[model samples]
Every structure is written in structure tokens, then in C-alpha cells.
Target: MVQSGNQNKRETDGGTSLESYTVRDPERFALNLARALEEAGKAAAAWSRPREAGEKPDTMAEPLADMVKTFSKLTEYWMSDPARALEAQTRLFSSYMGIWANSIRRMSGEPAEGEPVEPEAGDKRFQDPDWATHAFFDFLKQAYLVTSRWASDLVENAEGLDEQSRHKARFYVRQVSEALSPTNFIMTNPQLLRETFESDGENLVRGMRMLAEDIAAGKGELRLRQSDYSKFELGRNLATTPGKVVARSDLAEIIQYAPASQTVLRRPLLIVPPWINKFYVLDLNPERSFIRWAVEQGHTVFVVSWVNPDERHGNKGWDEYFREGIEFGLDTIAERTGERQVNVLGYCVGGTLLAASLALMAQETDDRIASATLLTTQVDFTHAGDLKVFADEEQVEAIDRAMKEKGYLEGSRMATAFNMLRARDLIWPYVVNNYLRGRDPLPFDLLYWNADSTRMAAANHSYYLRNCYLENNLAKGRATLCGKRLSLAEVKVPVYNLATIEDHIAPAKSVFTGSRLFGGPVEFVLAGSGHIAGVVNPPGLNKYQHWIGGALGESLEGWLETAQAAAGSWWPHWQAWIEKLDDTRVPARKLDRRKKMLGEAPGEYVRARV
Candidate 1:
């Protein structure tokens, strides 16, 4: 099992053995209260400001107004449906009373009816032995659960808010509730108390130091334990696959892997990974490297390593990415391999760009692309998942202004937004371990790669938000790139699409919608796991399963119903499909150099920090 410095300690008495139960520094609480009051006063002043004639309104104003209107309607509904409200109140009261009665019975050494209450599977706060036997702790835990359940029910039953508004409201309510949990405070958490007693309050001092260091490291608001970059060096332990940088441009570097097989497919494979992250994710370690796997499968593999943008690239737009990134990658691959046609695979945002490029290529009657594969990509952003919360007009405008000032969106800023989506898993765990409990975060390869994000150009990011997220022009056939209007329907190449069931960034259903937009023969695969896991799924791990079906017709539900379940990674299936596309095998050709070879694989561009 993985070890943690802040793991809970067991007491000899079978109860929490703490020398002190109260906080040692009461002045800290006072300071916190004063800070909160000052912030509240500032907010009140800001709220009182009058709107300018043509100035845009505050982004939060509409949501706050909707919440007020929702509460008003809820009040009326509660009055109209007295019985329902009464029943809800009665249930809440009964739940509290039941906890109290159980506590009393346990205190008196009497057996209570049924089993004692246990925390939910995801809740690790009450896992301490004290909560199981201590009457006060047990009661507190039960009370919190009952109240949390009541609040959730109230939000679920609330009326007047549209689906989007309700979702936002629920998400915010969850954040508030999570923040108020007892585990976050030193007084209530057994782990914190235990650490304090064991370290004689040194743990808290160290925690404060750590917090200061984090703030100094430019993560004050995000509260994440910054990954130590020195631990994992690129092209050493991380991106270790042997390859050569065959071509370079302002936007990307093309890495062509050395062939593992005696003969390879005539048509080379070109991979387009998202520019928001380094390309090493696909070429991580030899065992988990999809690039290595494809090379082993006897297909010549080529991947695009996107440049981490800076001020110099602030003016680059989607048109530039298409012209200098994807198009350039394809041309370089064809030129090096001396092949007229190539198979292409795009992952996440790269897939979106690839689809747009294909549409433009089709419009111009360019038929170089033989087949297309999109991994966890969304072309139709109508239901683009939780990330849409950050794509609103006001939020986008604010981001645009920030990008204008900085020349690009900072990597840390984008990472923070993504972490908020799964805060419990990605954010709070680090806060508790690194700040509250004074423990260092475990070294995780995926998390390290995730933290190593890249910045986006200001013009490109703004256009992406407005055109893709805000207006959804690509699906409607109105998106223009490089002076050409493009549509997904115009692309007639054979397509293979993959979506993960639990992907929060690109919802499977949204991905499913893209399959319908294709006019050519399409194969849709549904893998089990989140966005990264599903895409990086290697064979023989037996970690997750995937589903495949015939053409996805008009409905996602119908496609799922007719899909066939498979017990292994979808990589083998993808290989089978690729093999069928081309049967002519030729001897593997070595890189001829001829001024095309730039350097070794996992080149210098990926190492450029934002």
C-alpha cells in the first residue's frame, strides 16, 4: 500500500488520545474572522456600484438574480404543497432525533437497532476509530450526513432555475458544503488533532510554512501541492521512447518513432495531441506508450509535439494552428515516408482541430487524409460538459482580457480550472495532506504530466471559446478557418471515434453527437474510465473494458443498446481496423536525415515551461 506521512495514528485506549483538543493558537482564528469581515465589506461595496450606460453587467449578477427568483418561487411552492414540505421537514427532524436516540443508547451501553451509521465510501474524514465508538463524534458525523442529505434534496427539488442554472447552483452548494465539513478544521478532525499531539504543535507550524511556500510558488488560490519537476525529467524516465525529430515548425515538432517490426504499413500514422499539454502523454513510458504500441504493431508512427506558447505566439489563431501545425505535420510525414496518403489520429482538442482541418481539406478537394480517428474529442459543444461553466460570455471576456494582458492563458490558470471540476479528488486531497496534515503529495506520473500543462495563444484561445464553446459554429457549418467555411459533414473519410463514459471534459454523449455529424462510415467505441485513462488504456492491464457497435444512427441511447461489450483495451480493435485499411506491407525504412532530422525524440520544445 502507498504510504502517507499524515496517515491516522491508532491510540492505545481505543479512543483518540490527544493531549489537547483545542487549537493552540486562538489568535489565528481571530485573524481569519477579521479577514473574512474585510472581504465581505469589500464585496458589499462592489455590489452597490451602479451599472454604466453600455458597460457589460457583472457575470454573477444573473446567477444571483436567478437564485433569488428561485427561492421566491420555492417559497410559494412550499406554501402550495404544504404536505410535501411538511413531510420533508418531518424526515429531517426524524433523522436528527434518530441520531440523538442512537447516541444516548450507545452511551448507556445498550445495543441500538440495526447497524451503527458509517460514512459514505468517498468520505474519508470519519474513518478514525474514535468516530466509531465515541458518542459525541458519532452523533456529529450522523448529524452532518443528515443535514447534507437534506440540503441536497432541497436543491434537487428547487424550482424556477433552468437546467444550466440548477447545475451551477448545485455545484456551488456542494463547494460550500464541502468547505464547511468538520475535517477541514483543526478542532474537529481527529487526524489533525493526532498530528498536533504527536508533533507537539510542530505539524501546524510546518503546515503554515508549507502554505507560505505554496503561495510563494504562485499557487495561493489553487492550494495544490506543486509537483516537483526535478523528480521526473523528460526523455529520461517519462518520455523514454526512442525516436527522431524529423521535422520542425513554429507551431509543432514532428517525432517519428523507430520501427520495431521488420516491415510496416505503407501508409504512415500521424498523431495530433492537444497543444494544451505536452505530447509526451501519448509516449509516456515504454509499457504504456501508445506510440510504442503502434510501432510494435508494424505501423510507422509520427506524433506532433506542440510548442508551449508564449508572448511571441500570442497572435497565432486556429487558422495558424491548422496551417502550421496539423497541415505541416501531415505534409512532413508524407514527404519523409514518400507516401501520398496517411492515417491520422487526434486526441481531445487536437481531434477537434483535425476534424476542422479535414473539412477544409475536403472543401478544397484535398484527399491526402485516408482515414480519421478522434479520441475523446467533441465537435458539437451544445452539451460540452462541466467545462462549459468557464465558457460563458462574461468568463470568456474576462479570460480574453487576461490573455490580452499576459499574451496567453497561463498553464497554472487552466490547470486550476480543471482541478476544480473534480475538486474532491484533485484539489482538497492535496490541501488536506499538504496544508492541513503537513504531508508531501505522493509521486504520481499522471498527476505530474497533468501539472506540466502548456499555455494557449490569446487570439487562438479567444476564437476557440467564442466559436466553439459559445456559438458552436463548427457543428452548424458556420465555423471559418483560413478564410474557408468548414463543416464536419463535409468530411467523407472513414472515421473511428472513441469516448469515455466518465470523461468530464468531453462527455461521451457530446462525442457521440460528433459520430452522427460524419457523412462517411463511422465506428464509435465507448471505453470505461475518465478522459485520460480511457485514451491511454493499454492492453493486458485488465483495468477497464470497452464497448463497440455498428454505425451510431440518430440516438446515443440506441447505439449503446446495440453495442457489444469487450473485456480488454480498445487498442487491439483499433489496430484491427487500421490493418484492414491497408494490406500492402513494405520493408521498414530508416530515417534518411537529408536535413529533415532535427534531433532526438521528446525534443526541446516540450521542455519549454510556461
Candidate 2:
């Protein structure tokens, strides 16, 4: 009964036409509508089911609601005029088919009409010659890329969802599309396929064995290939710098490195590393060791080695880290070095604690802190980066509940979260290499230290999440520590702040913003690479570069625009700055035998495993 002219015209126009396929039969359209609704209902029921403990609650509810509204509108259009509904369905199919056809044409040596589909700059999987030479594989790669773009466009344009919800939708969609890439699959991946055939299908058998081994290891997910944990021992190869633990507490130990210079700065240096990981990250390998480098620069260095906390230490709070950790270390350094004032440095979360400790010290008119250096630390949570996605009230509460059950946050859990942020680089490579290729993981010093994680006390972690992240209390000067209200503005010591350009954990912008919060003259430096690499960068390698601004500006953009790029490491620059502040040079002093010595350089606490 309906006119077939539009349908024929659309078909004749090829896949480029946006006209819907005309449904000549009304009953058929009604039946399709019923089937779609039935499937949606089933999906809704499944989504509503109770989730397992520690599982992240679904964030797709709003997006799913928007989808349901779209479907309902389409259903109404079908009921009113089945022909229009058919046209809508046809238009959607044609759009997708057109995309595939264009990809095919490009793969077949036909020039593409618009800009060519290019892989993301960082994605190098398709850079191989086979991907370009082989038409079939090239088509697969192009098709997947085009599909991902189309999906992203749809999510970006979707209506009825809030900004945050839309962001969540886009992120999840990207993750899903990336996971489904042809390069990830054995059959579609040219390299993997060739390797499989060359190995006579032995790779598949080995992959199966590798997967079973991972499961048996009780990690429940494949992370890395079987690593020889014994090869990279602490205090031997890594964290091998010559030092001695002079003081010990339940929370931390102060290690005083033997000076490498004839004359050292009269004021000693105390390093406070994040309790989230072992302290030896600063002292890892003599060549790349920051502590050793400082000692060589004629600055007596002392590091706080935090205890790998357990259920018994679950009740420890931020106060303990300040009173028994930073303050205690400062006291020990002053006692051993006979220096009334000591230069202080803090890394990541340790910087946050140091900032609070300085504020507390200022409140009581304590003048022990001569200067402070903050490395890749964020006191302001306003722009804390992608990690903010997990800082929502619901997510934080869920984390708290999980931590309560275990009495502490498991290191493996935190590692997994950090890995997810860079899954393409950190996670999936291991998946393909360890499982698909069935190869053992190569031993790397950095990866070995990264694998050695530490648990966080529940009370301390919860307070940090609530006050620092969720509430933005620290930046607002509302954060309370050590039974005193602390303010960064009150701590008026000279401050040197370092931020990494590619750091995801503590974004450079966030760090820069926090640097401005200090009441004193602040020197903010932007380094290349990520969090760890930026801090551990040495002079000789001349690998990544850094940027230094002449003057601290009000905005990060303005500062970056005025900054100048420098070759080599930022270590020398930092050393020069600290030396300028410290004019008192005295002969290097030996450790007093009267002081109680805890143990050797990489203390017993550093050896504790999660």
C-alpha cells in the first residue's frame, strides 16, 4: 500500500543515501519493535542485579536511559508510520555500510575522498609494512578505526546526559573500541598471525599454559609473564646506595647516606617519599639515584623509609605520618647533623604530607624547615586529572567499604587502578607478549620496582580521599592535621616545585596550581616524561628534556609560554637552586657512633613485600 518509489531511489543512490529502507509490511515493523524492547528489558534486568563486593558500580545508567529514550522515539515513529521507521533503520545501516565501503576503497589503492584515516599518534601496532602492503589486513585496520571514530561521534553528540555522564560514556566507549581493535586479535594481527603459523601453532598451546599459570598465581587476571622475583633483590642491585638507618619508628625509618663530597652543606637534607611505595625509588641504582646525586652535590641526604603497613597498622592516620614520620625524621636529622635548620624534600603524596607538616610547624612558630621541594605533588585537587573519575562519592565509599573489610587497601588493587590509566602501554602489551606470544617477561629494573607495591592503612587512605581529593580541603586551608588546622599560606619557606609534563597521576597543571598556593617565593619546574622518569632523570643520558620559566606566573599557560627548554636533566638546576639558598659550607661530618643505628642502607622495612 505504501509507495516504493523512495525505497528504490535510495537503493539506486548507493550506500551514501540517508533514506531509510521502506518497510512495506506494518506487521513486520511491529514485530521488530517488540523484539528490540524485549532484548532491552533483559539487558536492564541484568544491569540491575546486585554487584559483587569491591566491584565498581555501573556508571552507564544515564547513558542507557538516553539510549532507551532514543529507542522509544524510534518505536513511536514506527507506530505512527512504519515507512518512516524503516527509513530510519535503513539510513543507519547505509551510513555504516558507506563507511566500510570507503575504507575498502582506500585499502584497494583507490584514493580516499577526505582526509585519510590515521592511527592515533601513540598507537604503533599498524606501523608495520605488512599492514600497508596487505590489502585485506589494511582494510581490517581501516574499518576498525573508522568504526571507533563513528562510535565516538555518537557518544559525543548523545543528548539528555550530563557533562560528567557524557565523559564517562566517552571514556568507556573508547576503552571498549580500543580493546576490540584488529591488532589485539591473533587472527587479524599480521605479526601475531605470522608468528602463530611459523611456530606451528605451538604459540597457542603455550598461550593456554601461560593463562592457566596466571590464574593459578591467584592474581585472577594476567598482568605480567612469570618474573624471577629473586634476581632483582633489594639493597643489592636496586637501592644499593651506601647509607645507614639512623632512626626507626612504627611508621618510618630515617636513612643517612654517607656524603660523597669532601665538604657538605652545613644544613642537611631530609627526603620524604610517598608511603604508597617504597622509599628506595629515589635511591634506585647508583647511576640514576637522586639521593646519591644529592650526596655527591655536597648535601647530606636523609630518606624516610615508610613501613609496608598491614592490618595491625590500619588505624594509623595522616597525623601519625606527620608526627612519627616527617617530624620524627627532621628531629633525627637535626640531632645527627647538629644542624638547627634542615632542607626538606617530598615526593608525590609525601609532598602533600610535608606541606601539612610545614603548616603545623608554622602554626607553633617552629622554624626548623629552611626550604621545601615538592616533586610531582598536588595539594589542590581541583584539576587532579583522570584519577578524579574514581574520586566520586559513590566510588570513594565503595573503596572505603572494601578497605574496611581487608583492614587496608591492597597494593595489587592500587596497582591495577594505576595500570588501567595506561592500559595500552602497561597492560595489553603483557597480554599479547605473555599470553599470545607465550614469552617470559624480560627483566627490567623499573618494572621490578613497580611490581613491589605496598599496602595503605585504611584510616589514612580514607581521610586522604575525603579531605584532599573529594572535599578539596587542603587547597582551601580547611584541612586539619596533628590536631591543628593547617594552611599552605602560613608556611612561608622558600619552595621548589617540580611537575612532569606527561604525568597522569599528578597532572602538571594541578601541580602548578598547588605551587601558587604557597605563600613564599616558589620556583616551579616542568619536566619531560612521566612521574617516575621525570624525577629519576640523570645528566648523562640526555634523554628527555625539561622546561624552566624565568618567573612564576599566575597561570600555567602563561608560564609555559614564557618557559625555555633545556637539555639533559633538571638535577643540576635543582642542585644549583638549593646551593644558592644554603651558603654555609662545612667539612663533611661522620655519623656519630653514639646514635642508635637501626640497620643498613635499604632498611628492613624496604624489604617488606605486599
Candidate 3:
């Protein structure tokens, strides 16, 4: 028990008792303290050796510098008028005073006055009982929340700032706020502090050792461990949908899965998975594998397993990828299966490339593709979420300069960018769990695939950023592809567009708007979760939900007003759509018939780690 008055007294730290801060095991702590120092030395060695060996990247982005400049704009707006600056200061100071008063009342066994500050529902940061029940922690939590929220609002409501500046300000604020959270520090975090006391600081010693190991693993960079990577291997356990590598190109390998059904659909399906990551996301395990499920559904599935690009593919642009990747897949499919026209499915960047390819095909009167399905793909990047913040001209130019020297962008750069999109969930938790808690992460297949990143070819990534993001060219029917103007409006293939309702990479509104670009009948469907879970959800799992409606309206909100909701995965609904288009059947095509078997499925390309 502690008294509220005289906070500076030795017996109390504000309202928390000084006596309560005692280590339960003093002898254990005394022994572990030396070990903790030794571990700290190891962590320092791990950091310095990479720089000494010149292994540290010279072109690593200076985000902090950019953040400083972005925040300065917000600083200017608030400081322009003395009265405005004073008002802002007053607002913050008032919130602090309220928190102090509330803390005193709480110590005296009284209710808080109207709850001046509280964490929003679903925010897991302040979930500890001490954060609410204890006076000091509760005050600290409320004070931090109020100040951070106020800071964010200042940026959001700032006038005389351009859209881009405003956006950068908001993003930077969030990054700063999250980084500065009290929970991140052992001193401020009750749980971490308690753990340290109980473990006699041995937790920190082990965490430091792991931190050193992770730094060493990343080769001078921090590769935050989200899962036990040792628990997974492609083709062995993860990408285990039995398949053969029927074809290989400079950019991709074509894998034809074994048909489970004796008779399969005549129209063979080719999946173009994003080259930014491995193809195993769709085929993580037998139960969650869409590839395995599709084979069970009597479809001859062939997937494009893209190469982990390097210096050799530096100059490979969008056209080359269109030619060497998709065209190569089409050629091999025709030769191996004797099917000219095929059904196609593309995920993420693969979907964007496929849509553009179909558009290019439309122009050349090439009708090889019968129908198309795009999974969480964006043709228009207007509402593409936080990713657009990094695609600005300045940042894109910096990426260009870096890529020019290195030949290709490092896989970790893209991985970091994607992680930033959901940092509260993806980044900090791992930081706390892996480093603070001194524990190996539990085995999770999706996270394992997420960590297994792939490099981006220079020219291809640049063109994509400029055309799709910097300019809304593809949606506007002005994007040039293969020495010809590309128009999504010209693409007449029946399209099935899937968008995750909670997608940060590709917002449903953006997908719904882009649907209007297609010349053919576009069936816009909304899945239940975010990008990965939304698309990879298998029907047999009996999880999540989906929405399919009569027709899309001018706006997403208008369409959702009338859209019908159905429980479970969207895969069966998509398969049903495929049947409605063309359901011809033929004997399952043997894999080793036409093209020589180059390798096994989940090819050697995916095995290349950066």
C-alpha cells in the first residue's frame, strides 16, 4: 500500500510503493547482472562487426531525416500564430492537469471525473490491470494517450498544408508515438519490470543474447523474429501440394500440380503469384493450401513461382517481366496441356501484372486468356493506403538511385515497408516478445512465409511505382506496355475481382473504383479479413465470411448498402463463378508429357535467400 500525497517521498514513487519494487531473489539478480553485461557486449559485437566488414547497406533509407522535415511543417503551422500555439499548449497542459487530479481521486477510492482519456477499444497496449487499477500507471497511460491523440489531431486538422505533407505528418506522428510508447521500455512497463525482478534480470540477459543472434542473422540489420523459421521448409512441409516444375524462365518457374481428380476441367488454371514474396503463401500447408484445394476441385493448376531476382535481373523492366514471366507461363501451359485458352488467377502484384497483361492481350487481339481472377490486387493506387506515402517522387527517386548502384532492391527493404503498414501488430509486439521476453516465437506458417522475402528487380519495381502509384495511368487507360498504350478498359476478359474489406495494401474502395476500368463484366467481391487471411482462407476451415452482390455502384458505400453477405471462404463462390463461365471436362493431363521436368514444385528460385 502507498500514500498519494508527497509524491517525492522516498517510500513512494508518485503513487506506486518503493517497497514493492524489491527483487524477490536478490542472490539470483546479483549473479545474473554480470551475465547481462556480457550479453550486452555480444550484442554490441554483433552490431559493429557487420559495419567493420562493410556488410551494412550504404543505401539504407534515412527515414528519421525525412520525418524531421515532415514534422517541421506541422510545427510551422502551429507556431505561425502565437495565440494558436498557446491554445495548443494550453490544451495539452489541461489534459495533464486533469490526469493528475484523476489519479489523486483514484488513490482515494473515488471514480475518475468523466474519463478525460482512455485507450480506444481493441488497442492491446494498455491491457494490463495495473494500467487501469494502479494510480501512477493509469495517469501515465491517460497522459500519454491524451498527448499523442492531440499531436495527431494537430496534424490531421492543420490548415495551409498540402495533401502529401499532411499525409506524411500523420504517418510520422504514428511512427513516433509508437516508438516512444512507455510499454517499450522495461523501466515503464509493469510486466517487463516485474519479470526482471522475478527473473533476477536473467530475462534481459537471454533477450540480449537473442538480440545479438538476430542482428547477426540479418547481417548487421535487425531481422525481427516473428516465428520459429527452423520449423518450416518449402516442399518438405510448407509448400507440400505435390507438383512438378514443368518449365523455367529467367524470371519464373512454372509448376503443374498433381491432379487429385481423374477427370479435370478442360480449361487449365495458371496462378501468377507476386514475385515480391515466395508462392508458398497460397500453399502454406495441406489444410490451408489453395493449390491443394483447387486440385481437389478438378482443375489442372499451374502456378508461376517467380525467381528471387538479383544483379542479373537489374535492367529487367515491366515489359520483360510480362514477356519472360506471364508469356513464358502461357507458352509452357499450351505445350504441356494442349490448351490454348486458359483460366488465370493473380495475387497481389501478380494480379496487377496479369490485369495489365490481359489489357495488352486485348490490344493485340490475343485471346489466350478466357477468364481472369484478381486476389487483393490494385490497378488504381489512389486509395492504396499507407503504401502511397512511400511512393512519392522524392522517395521513389531515392529508391531509383539506390537500385542503380545495387542493381536490385534488397528483399528486407520491401519486407520492412510492408511491416510498417501494420507496425502496431507486426513490428513492436515482436520487438517486445523476442527481445524483452527472451523467448523464441511460436511456429506460425504465414509468418514464416512473410519472413521469407524476395528481392525486387530495379526496372520492374520502378515502373510499377511510377505508373501504378505516382500516376494513375493504368486506371486512366494511359499506361504504356510493350511499346503500346495499355488500357484496362480494352481488356474484355470476364473478371472476378476480390478485395479484402480490411486490406491496408489495397483498400476495398480502391478495388471497387478500379472495377469500373475493366471493359468486361466485373464481379467485385469483398472478403472478410485483411490481404493474406482474406484470400488464403480455405473453405474447409469454415472461417470468416464474404459478400457478393448484383452489381457495384458508383461508390463502395453505395454498393455495400445492397451487397449480400454469406458465411465462410470465398474460394467456393469463385469456383462456382468459374463453372458458370466454362465447365468443359477432360482426362487429367499427365505432367511429364510435353516439356522435360526441370525440377520439383516450389522451385529452386524460391530457395534463394537474400
The residue pairs that clash in candidate 3, if any, are: none
lDDT (10s digit) by residue, model 2, range 1-610: 2336555454211222212223345565455445544544543333343343324344345434544554454345345667755665565566557656766775565865655467888897787565665555666777788778766765565555555555555556666677788888877887776665455445655665666655434334333543555578888899988889999999888899887888989999999999888887887788888888888888888999999999988889999988889989888987898788999999999999999888889898999999999999999988887667566677788778778876798887677667767767777777787767767788777777877889989999998999988899999989998788878999899999999999989999999989878888898999999999998998977878889964577778889889999987999899888989976899997777687887898889988886
| Residue 593 Cα positional deviation in candidate 3, in Å, after optimal superposition | 5.3
- Tens digits of lDDT, candidate 1, 443-470: 7677889888789899889988998888
Which candidate leads in lDDT?
3
Considering lDDT, which of the candidate structures 1 and 3 is the better prediction for this target?
A: 3
Residue-pair clashes, model 3: 0
- Give each model a TM-score: 0.86, 0.83, 0.95
TM-score (C-alpha, index-matched) for candidate 3: 0.95
Per-residue lDDT for 131 in model 1? 68
> What ranges in model 2 sit over 4 Å off?
1-99, 102-115, 158-163, 219-230
lDDT of 1: 0.79
- For residues 1-610, write the lDDT of model 3, one tens digit per residue: 2223344244332434444455756777878878878887988888789788886754445676677888888999999999999999998998888889888887786777874577888789988776766677777788889988998999987999999788888888888788888788887777777678767788888888899888888887788889999998888899998889988889989999988988999999999999888998999999999999999999999999898999999999889889988999999899988899999999998999999999999989999999999999999888887888888888889989888987899888999989988888899888887788787899999999999999999999999999999997888888888999988888889999999999988888888888988999999999999999999999888989999984677898888888899999999999999999989999987777555888888888889998
Write the candidate numbers in order of decreasing lDDT.
3, 1, 2
Off by over 4 Å in 1: 1-94, 113-126, 219-223, 226-228
